[model samples]
Target chain A: MRMPKLTAFLMATAVFASALVASADEVHVLNWKGYGADEPWAIAAFEKATGNKVVNDFFNSEQEMLTKLRTNPGLYDVVMINAAFNDQAMAEKLIQPIDVSKIPNYADISADKAGSPMLARDGKVYGVPWVWGLTALAINEKAFETPPTSIAEMWNEAHKGRVTIRDDAVEAVQFGAIATGQNINDIKDMEAVKAKLTSLMPQIKTFWSSENDWNQMVASNQIDIGTYWSGSADRAKTHFKLPVSLVIPREGAVAWLDAFSIPVGAKNVAGAEAFINTMIDPKFYVEWVTKVGAPVSANAKAVAALPEDAFNRKVMGDPGVAKRIQFQAPISDAQREAYLALWQELKVNVK
Target chain B: MAGQVATGARSGLRSALPLLVPAYLWLTVAIFMPLSAMVFFSFMTELPLSGKAWSFTLDNYATFFAQGLYRTLLLASLKLGLEVTLWCVVIGYPAAYVLAKVFRGRSREAIFLLVILPFWSNGLVRIFSWAMVLREGGILDTALNAVLPFKINIDLMYSYPAVIIGLVHSYVPYMVLTCYLTLQAIDDSLIEAGRSLGASRLQMLKRVIIPLSMPGLVAGAALIFVPVVGSFMEPRILGGRTGTFYGTIIEDQFVAVFNWPLGAALSFILLAVVLVILALASPVLKRAA
Candidate 1:
């Protein structure tokens, strides 16, 4: 009787341990809503392939994402952070260096993105560069006889009361920096930037805050030319059928990258790696790009696999464009406050 | 006799304690605790939870005093509040008088529903709907151009007037609802007495209706003015580049610039100003009561 009871107890322990292991396979993801990670089909495919369940939470802004990570340590196994904020995340120890070996698809990522200083620290990779896009000029094709070649066209008298820009201090300051022939990440003369933005104010009909706002403003002819995202511009033209064309001016454009990283003290590190690998897979990239209209894939193989006339392939595929692009860098808190103050002052004086 | 009264009062307190416990507990948890925490944070140099080195500092409040922009925007917001409140009163008082004095039975109920209809829809959808009506080739423009002999462009989107229109549309219902309640409560005999005294219809309204409805009018103005002073959304959606206000700047400090300490300070300042305004209006409100 004693032997039989002991055997039954051992069996129960084995079953409970297996259940624990199964529960541990679940991956919690933090990302922007609708930004590739939480796609239903992708999540289903990843779950089926790796036998790991995926759950997602979304943040509306990058700062909100940071706050979430800081407040909820060990809750999120995977997080999507912008390249510009990678250093700050790393410094705060919010995310850990990802083991690239676990992500087999990492080999196919473009060297420029994979090796970017923004994603690495002291020879260790903290993030897997996922997607990139440009914040360049998007113009109403029907409104212009010829495409604008320079960022200075935003100030042209012809487009007065027909031009717009985003209502963001960082974007406005960066645009000013670019127009003044200064690096976006490093501006030596903020006075020049302030002066440039102040002059552009009268030409602006309005300022858009979201992709929907941009679409409405342009569709109604409330604006003729404005600073817009490349991916959003592509969606406007292809999905909404708006007569919009993105222009990479002679002064180049502001570029930003988004990456997937494992949060520090995550319970399911392997599951997080598996999810990120699936996220950057070429097949997934092609589907996301063609159907949903996403930013350009960081994976070189994925871009090459897209159709010849794919908007990203036609516009951002050139190596020369890569050289001209200025990838955003981490901004100090003091610098951000200064930009905000200047932007607010300019908005107050716009009329 | 005093001792007996004190005993009675103690017994009354003992009886009411159980009923008041839940309410006081809720207030302590939901309102006072958070407000106390905000007060503490307003004096800090940084967010204490951000894992950064921080200490108590008066710099946050000092920045407000040193900067002229905050004062300018706060004044602008006050002006906006005053304009919106006056418009609500001008538009709503007459409608309320009609609802209370003229309309009867089912027609009154139907019109009353129409007055409160703006509350049925989401605030954003309503604002956007106004945008559709007020844009250049929008409903208003299209209708006007279709009926008129000459082509007149009505590009009101992204202007100050658009913001005012959207805000007034949103808040006028408050004025109507409050004034209607008060006007309905006033004895109809008062108006009859005024008219029997050989008063004109206008004189009857000025003497009998307006004075009696003062409570509701004061209540409605307070309701509209408080929110409008701190409003950021309607102004943003409709006012375009012209939309930057004190409230929007405070929003920027927290969300865009990650300056929570400064945001807390600015918020505290706005709260203090609002309190002072309410304090100044208390005598009038009490008199109306």
Candidate 2:
């Protein structure tokens, strides 16, 4: 009798375990930490709604993201890629085109963001546009009585030793291109960009590499003005109560779009699509932007749902600001290497 | 007799092979294999794993030689390594002497722990702490202003000196620990004899104590100089705009530019430079030993 009872219990446990495994599919997501896909609350909501469990991995840089995708094939079900890198991912065959019909919310993406050349190859959409933001000038509210309107303020002799910029090669070159009244994506005059950046070096107090570093510098009064991300500026101002205000100068700012892509050979394509769709849902976007600061949503309906005074809307809502924005484009590997070499050379010569 | 000796040696080797296998296997997997792979990759045109076109090429190495920037940065890193090692010796030698010769029993143990306390925390945290003390409105500036009659700005953040200070703080413990081991092993009677023979304190330190501890000093210098020469974090965190170095440039090649071949060549070049430096120092090290 005791043996029979034990057998019955063992069989029951096996059945329950199999039931649990069959009902929930685990989706592995690779993204930047704190990005929408990784937020605990969003993950919980997705799991509850779709019976799909979300697991997250994070990368610090877009290059690192690509490295992970290349090296760990089939390990990640979903990856968040900057649109500028989507072409490279497709060329490497690391990510697959998403079937937009599977993602109901994909249609809600803003028309401009939907038509991004980087996200699609030929006709199929390889990436689902998620968020967009600007790398623009942010100033200490206390330092500027009237907000500066020109990118040239960074090089003004009066602000010498009080200015800063990011330490990325691509961003720095794009910034220099803008300052020289050239297109960020297609600058014809390399020498002019080089000369303009070199002249700005004396005015630079230092270079910041991360959002945390930028905030620390501002909080300690280390720098009064610097190039910073629009979303991060909102967080610094509203969440941390930092005295910073993001400004889109007349010369324009560099715009970047991030997207969610399903990696080729992903085991759980259905689960990955569900996760992406849920992330773009207006309900989720509104909650994410209102509670935790984020880049402007790519879903037009989600943007409309945001409060009238939302930080993203106030700064990015103006159509004129959109006209002035220069979206980053795919840069060839050789061009990127040249930019890196030039940036390194410039940094080495800094006194 | 020679045949018998050879047979005996062969038997000894056969017996020892089993005991040596694990260690050799570990070394092959951990050190030799990775190094061989890097050397192989350094000669390639592109990373084979990237599914890109590839070929054997010397362009990576050629780029390093053709560009004067790499050479300049390498020299700067060597200079930084030398300066930091010197500061470590200056600050650490005295403290090590006190721990080895002056303090006794429990006091010695307590003070020794204090010397190595910095290692308990993360290197990044320690560097950040120095930033707190060295920044313009930091603790040092506040304390100085309170005492001094005139106002003075003491901003050291993002400066070369700040980098030097942070590095010394992080590595001085190595000098102290190594020197302490050798200094403690020296017989006190030798010092007493030197004193009895009319050698002054300075002369005793220069002639007896230093010579006896030369092995430890050289070891500490080697340990500190190698890592300091390749250091990128402290310089990046502290030196700011002026922080560009050979190490950081190599880091960019691998992470930023995805130029693994160039990064590998650069790394091998740095390894060669370090090996040459060690080879130069071996004569002194052997003499001291």
Candidate 3:
């Protein structure tokens, strides 16, 4: 009787141990494509170090990501959201405040980026700065004898019908404001924005919406200059061998920063924190920046550690280049509506 | 016997339910439910799914009136649709007529397949392919430059003409297919009869062939016009900066601006306009049928 009881106890212990071994801590990350720590070595090391698995879901745009997060609460443990959208995400209680104590590498981020209002709210830190990029002017190098240095160059009569702009209303309106020497951020006066944007109509050959479309135009010599992300121009030159170059106009460019935030009701907060820390590890950041081309990492050590080759792309690792970036502040919902309304009018009257 | 007949009719319906249910159920779930939901959401202040404060309001519709932009864009889109449909009719009807009446046997079948071969591949990819042909220094440019003594620049990449070309190319196949279907059913005897009655070829075509094929023409026009009016992708890819339409604005609301209620209102209004158009065309269609 004693022997049989001991055998049953051993069998139950074996079953319980198997269950424990099967269930690993998981961190579900919602981010843009190519934004996550996608390197095999990084992923493997992370999994081995923390015994947690990272699963990723990607969104093409901020609004799409917002829609997914808003519709499915607690679905994602970690989200890499645009800094401009952090306010709205927090206001809606979609994401929760971060405990800095849980993320040790959070301290290694540059002070300027760390102290930005985008990552903090009500004196409580909400996000860890991840990567930074800019939406600047991309020009075909062969189109002009000299490099254009000002945003106003886009509207010059000489380049009439040879230029393109992004098909984004806010960005277009902001550029218009900047061009006309009006405040890009506040944008209180609708008529001013309208007048400025409408003045650009004669010069615009077309408005491109996608990077691929812009690249094709450049390759086919359809447009002399256009508005696209700075990193995309770098990628195009390196990958497609396009004769394109990115320019930061004297009027300043709209800069965006992406950061990692934990959503409210996240099932694995600890694992999410670990994943965020792992992402900012200098070794991982180096690999990420090297592989992904020239988007700056917020971590100072990572920037310092980048080899001369990756560091040569001054836009990526140079702090001086970052100073030229004018970060876009979050806008009120009403402002968004008014801007879209005016933009629609501008589009209708483009001819 | 009357009771037996009633029972037979009931049994027929019962047997048909299985076949009808799958399709009707799919339509109800996929089409009707979303459409009804859109109408319901159009009257709201905010998206209820967002868990934000919201209320019922017609201000969304009122904005359409308060601002004339939506109406203007809608008019522009309709004009685009009309232009594309007319071009397709001019270009496609003749090709379709040849396919139906001119050629015979294997060649006709093969040509018909070639005409619609584009529809098989992805629509977006096909639109992109046109960029290689229509843009500056593209196939058309290289070909033209190769033959001409002097250089003549051909840069239609982001122009209104480019948009029209892309749209017509995308939708002309519909015209061919529909016109071919109806034109094929017309008997040769009717043409011979018209000829015997002292009618000329043009007269026979104008009075007989055209009138007989009115159903296909109307059907093709409706089919082409509806989608073209709602097209945003073709214009974006081919029209460049010149490509904002009513459909693109509606798209902006959902994806760019994150305003579902407003987008829903815009979509619902578009649906109403489309329904009215289809309604107006129904009488002519019925007569032709």
Candidate 4:
């Protein structure tokens, strides 16, 4: 039994070794599922124009991406990471500085969004904003005739078994702080946050990790209200044909930005730059945002090109919408450790 | 004659070396080296790979003892393991008995194959399939409601029970396969002998058949319990809000918190617990063997 398996393994290893040695003109990209160059047109058009094939790989989180880049050097050309992780990525030198000159489309970014600290370090641009969205309440209109207006509704006894919260420690703790009338960014009393999270345990039917998890819960009528991403809400409504809509509660929502950057040991720098430029093209952004459902575009031309009834225009054009949503901010490792500890306590106490 | 025998034994050893070396080499590279590395890393304050300034510390293990939450979560995971294994035994043993004893000829072979068929598909996909069947307005609900006179809510998704159901469904096949092999190996004449010696049906089952199949029960229990203790995905997908366990926290350390040292320590602790359980069970297992 083992002899046959051993022979087969040896044969397979020989095949893979040869495959790795064979050179190809391809820009290997590492990103989140369904993100940049994952679109057929982006890959097809890039390959047609640049004569470089696109290879895509994905990770579920920034930490996983960082680990891959650190461990598997030269495996990926372009990577998309959360804006909040730019400092750590730079400090570790896992990613290299961006050559803005090579990417002419860098000028397409709006001044306000371009000022993000994640974009520049030591006066050198590192990454370009790829997509941005907010974590807010996604309610099924069929379940809620009047949309919920506050994060407090997540704890309402009336909807005890219909509420789904995010499973993320930072997001859950931040929202817990927000629900208890504290600034989410500057959490002073972790005990208070943990207490708040513990109190809401009875109300949550389940905790979801991904946008697809939230969508499935709502689509199947398993959950009526959830802490969901705005982009996911749009996708769920269109794809699942569910009566779901995203509403930023009175306590506000956490906004996050993902940016494209070149890894330190990229073999195809020119191809990687071309891919990023192609991703930010106004025409591409317009079609990308509309079809894929992004909350907003960082590209000035793309933002201006939105139609009157477009999802981004309606959401981003609202007065003080940008101010109301709290952008993703970096936290000290000590704070992160403290928050994780409290999160453990909250989870353990979830009887 | 003694010198010739010694030369023959030496040749036998040389012949076996080629096969034995590969297996031991594989074990050293795959299991032993990683375990040693994990142990070494568990003593560090930070990851050594990043070339960041780091120092040796016992804080990772210390933190496990410092927090009551970790202890509680470990106990909960152990309880979950027990619950799942017990359910597997309750559900799988009867099916194994039916297939081995009651079913005959072509049907027995087909039924045995059908019992283990779910194992062929992806475990993750099978777990997710249960989500579809157990969720609100799902297949089970729709089917039951269609047959019943009165409408009723039958949603079981996201609850603790759903996690148990999904795990049992996923692991029951292992128990069935193990128990079936042992049950089939037991001579039917021995069971008949027990019955002919004034033993009732229950006595024959409890005395002759069950004692003979103890090895299979122990083997299946060990198989199910070890993985169940380390399981995170099943709870996450099926348990919903109630899914957090020791395994998930260990997952969070490596993936979410970027705390490799702490994760390693936690994993080591879980390994110790599993070793202790197996050690305690070894006596009974030896007797059965």
Q: Write the per-residue lDDT of candidate 3 for residues A28-108, one digit (tens) a residue.
A: 788877655655677889989999987766776786677667766666889988888899999888899999888989889
Write down the lDDT that model 4 would get: 0.81
Chain B of candidate 2 achieves a TM-score of: 0.92
DockQ versus reference, model 2: 0.32
Candidate with top DockQ is 4
For each candidate, report its DockQ versus the true two-chain complex.
0.33, 0.32, 0.33, 0.40
A1-351, model 4: which lDDT tens digit per residue?
112223433453454354342134788888877764698876888899999988877776666677667766776788887888887888888889988889888898877667798668998878888778888888978788789788887788888888888877888888887777777778788778877888888888888887778777776767778788877787777666878998888777888887888988788888889988888888788877767766577787777798877667777557577767788777767778777887777777885
Clashing pairs in 4: A206-B241
At residue A262, candidate 1 shows an lDDT of 93
Q: Which residue pairs in candidate 2 collide?
A: none
Q: Give candidates' CA RMSD values in order.
A: 8.3, 7.9, 8.9, 4.6
**How well is each residue in B68-106 modelled by candidate 3, as lDDT tens digits?**
788988888889999999999999999999999999999
Model with the higher lDDT, candidate 2 or 4? 2
Candidate 2 residue spans exceeding 4 A from truth: A1-24, A71-75, B1-25
The TM-score measured for candidate 1 stands at 0.93
Interface Cα RMSD of candidate 4: 5.6
Shift of residue A185 alpha carbon in model 3, Å? 2.4
Question: On TM-score, who's better, 1 or 2?
Answer: 1
- Candidate 3 colliding pairs: A206-B241, A207-B240, A207-B241
